[model samples]
Target chain A: MPPFLYIFLGALAVVSALGVIIQRNPIHSLLALIATLMTVAILFIGEDAVVVGFLQIIVYAGAIMVLFLFVIWLLNLQVETGPTGHLALKLFGSLAAALLVTELFFILAPPHLQVKFTHEPVGYGSLASLAGTLFTDYLVAFEVTSVLLLAAVVGSVALARRLPGTDDPRAARKIAS
Target chain B: MIPLTYMMSLSAIIFAIGVAGVIIRRNILVMFMSIELMLNAVNLAFIAIGSRLGSMDGQVIVFFVMTVAAAEAAVGLGIIISIFRNRETVHADDLTLMRW
Candidate 1:
């Protein structure tokens, strides 16, 4: 929990993030993502959020990343070329993001604006408090999120199933032999 | 002893870099990594604010965001697989089926 560890982990997270961005290959990007996830999870653990930290590592670095790798393996993506879009879109996006950050700074700069990080009556970060609110006040939102996840699952399955006649070329060749 | 504000500043810079990466990267997987970077930046902000305020809401939010992120990763990777199945490419530009 030392400040140095916190800063070091944060720096590591940032570096892996850069790798994710700079890596051209999809598999390398996923590897970078996994590294970033591990560092962030360590950051959470260092911050004393034990449950969240564990969940971050388990759910993100473990299950979710495995899913990504599985799909990547299934797809067998070759190093195909991508578009070289005009520079204008990147320029516009950067300008817009900068403006947004500037506006946020201005908005948060007011002298009288006293923001409280935790205003809840019960102590936060505990499983009891989190479950209480998540099941009571925020119950509807939580259930809705589940439904959304279910829908996404269904949609993904639907998307992955091939069109009737589009037998995979490799499969077709195998069948021919 | 670095002040908490410095941590927040570093988080902000990291987030900005993530945003820039997402904007510039054409590969879907790289874009996803950039998003993870942004999320991690937010996580840093959360930890800093939580410690500064001596409160735990920031940590709680981080928990929720992490769960949501996992769900997103599952669905996103699934979608990526589906896209690759149809087009055999993971490039952002190849997602032209919807632009029409």
Candidate 2:
């Protein structure tokens, strides 16, 4: 049963990942991302880390994806041509992604790393333990994340309201609401 | 125990797919999704290692990552909306105002 769960979760992750890449429409891409996030959350669950899994679903699959969907709906964007038209931008993006992949490979490569997954998974730390670690070890990051959210709220509202040269009430209300 | 090599290879393949998407796609939103794919690929590595190491710290960090991803998506989508309003397009080629 456990092996079945593991294989199922892993396959879901890969399929949804492909879905995210293959879909062209932004809304469709967002939907694919939601599926991928959900599958990732499920993977956490299979690992017996229920809290992380739930948070993954709520924060990523729920709140974040809804925000992305709202923006996509608001924009009503038409599908654009492929990046093949712009060789420079495509080249730059490819180079950046390649650099990132290479860096990641170095970081996770087996010889340099000591940690390894074994047959016996560790017991989950209690929620209180998790919270304690988060506060003491990651307090600054926690506070900064809140500030970032606030800034995003303010910035989004502000950006949504701005008019090039004239005041626009519809735009203002759209932003305000 | 599952073979460590198999797990690593799976993650590597997934990561490669994400890199390809970011490079090949022109839509900024789709590009953003590709970024999410990359992040998830990383998360898989974290969890797999966490289980191997007999610790939950990696899982805990995954929790933190999920939070950051949410906040990032909010801000990124916000910016996308404003950009779309200004140009009425999401094409990579059309983002030339800042290009040199």
Candidate 3:
């Protein structure tokens, strides 16, 4: 809620995001991503979205990150070495990013475009209110997401399953032993 | 009260970093992480705007976004694992099986 807290957490999120981009090892990048997710959760809480903030932690930082780590270990990925693009491509990418940032700055800088924080009802971001709206108005969407998640689970399993007589060394070893 | 512009700007900056990551990183996993970063940046903007306007819709949308992100991560990692099984590499550039 405090201005200083926002500034501190925002800066930390930015730095961690940079770490995600710069780290050569995917494992290190995953760690940096965890930091970024945590900071974003804190920022969400600071903005009074308590449910979303905690959900960000439980889902994104906890479950999703563990999944990422599991995949990294499963594949046993090595250090990335370097990107495939040449120097010219890299320069062009940087230039494009810089231009995008500049454009965002100009769009966000107008004095008259600021959003006014009006008086909100008590318990605006409370769990009760969120649940009420979600169940009544967004129920269809909520149910659809559940179905989508189920589909994802099934699809992932199907894709990752090994076929019979595949040439995978690990599979062959399993059959041998 | 913190200015909404500051929060939005911060989100924009992070979004730019995410774009750069996607463009510059060759590892598919890291590129996926960058995409997550971009999603979070949008979530930040959504929450900020919702808070400023005294509405709850933005937070609700964020919940959906997080759900979609979770599903995407699952399916994507599964595909990556499949790719690794067949190709034994994770570099985006090395995935040329579909190319002519």
Candidate 4:
């Protein structure tokens, strides 16, 4: 990938990340997140991790985000009013983020300390190779993830389901009658 | 070719932004999105390091991370919905039922 393209995508990701923070509406924040995820997916592809990149799109950007949007619509959230937190808290948050960015810069700046790219076998990030390694080497983990997803599905349904008389006024009245 | 450090730096910046979002945002949904941002930042760093070392492990880990994140989102949102049903609000500050 070209250096300029990398820079462009990086900037795009950064800006969208900021948007996610700055937007007052959760819907807008989600849109910004979608942009960031897409940019990151492209970056992954640029790094030659094709399968990871596409999965980033199909899973993260596509399915997960749609789920988020669905929840947002279900909740019918209003636009957040005024500022989020106290001024002191906002200042502290910015200070902490700045400090973290500086620390990361110091850690990543030294070229000699960086991991150098080396030759890999052809088809490193291909779906076939990933599948081979996943099924053979990481089979247990793969199966565990499937189980986790199933559990999550069941748990979510259970949690979100309305109980008989918890908050339903009609149910309470019927029981009383 | 783009340098790996650039990718790492971008990841760090985004991660920091995510941290700030989590700290400053009061809405639970936005906070959840910020958490996702932080996770993506880590995934980006992992991919960069893995590519630099000529290994596929990082990408594979990213795959697992994405899966876990998906499950987390589902469960977390379900919890949020449950909370909303009980309280009719999604603001973190308003969720003071356990403060006592």
* Per-residue lDDT of candidate 1, residues A36-132 (tens digit): 8888777666655666777778877888788877876787754535543348867865776577566545544445325454433444456776576
Model 2, which residues run further than 4 Å from truth?
A78-113, A116-126, A162-177, B1-8
What are the chain B TM-scores of all models?
0.93, 0.93, 0.96, 0.97
What ranges in model 3 sit over 4 Å off?
A: A82-84, A112-116, A164-177
Model 2 lDDT tens row, A45-151? 66555777787787777777787777777777655444333567556655766676676567656775555445543345456656766787878877877887788
- DockQ class, candidate 2: acceptable
Q: In model 3, what is the error at residue B83, expressed in angstroms?
A: 0.3
Chain A TM-score per candidate?
0.72, 0.69, 0.87, 0.89
Please give the DockQ score of every candidate, comma-separated: 0.42, 0.48, 0.72, 0.75
Model 3, position A65, has a per-residue lDDT of 89
lDDT of each: 0.70, 0.70, 0.89, 0.91
Any residue pairs clashing in model 2, and if so which?
A116-B52, A117-B52, A118-B52
| All candidates in order of TM-score, best leading | 4, 3, 2, 1
Instruction: List candidate 1 stretches off by more than 4 Å.
Output: A78-114, A117-124, A162-166, A169-177, B51-56, B96-100
Best-performing candidate as measured by DockQ: 4
Of the candidates numbered 1 and 3, which has the greater DockQ value?
A: 3
> What is the Cα-based lDDT of residue A46 in candidate 2?
62
What is the C-alpha lDDT profile of model 4 across B1-100, one tens digit per residue? 5777888899999999999988888899999999999999999999888888888888888999999999999999999998877677889889887865
Which candidate number would show the highest lDDT if scored against the true structure?
A: 4
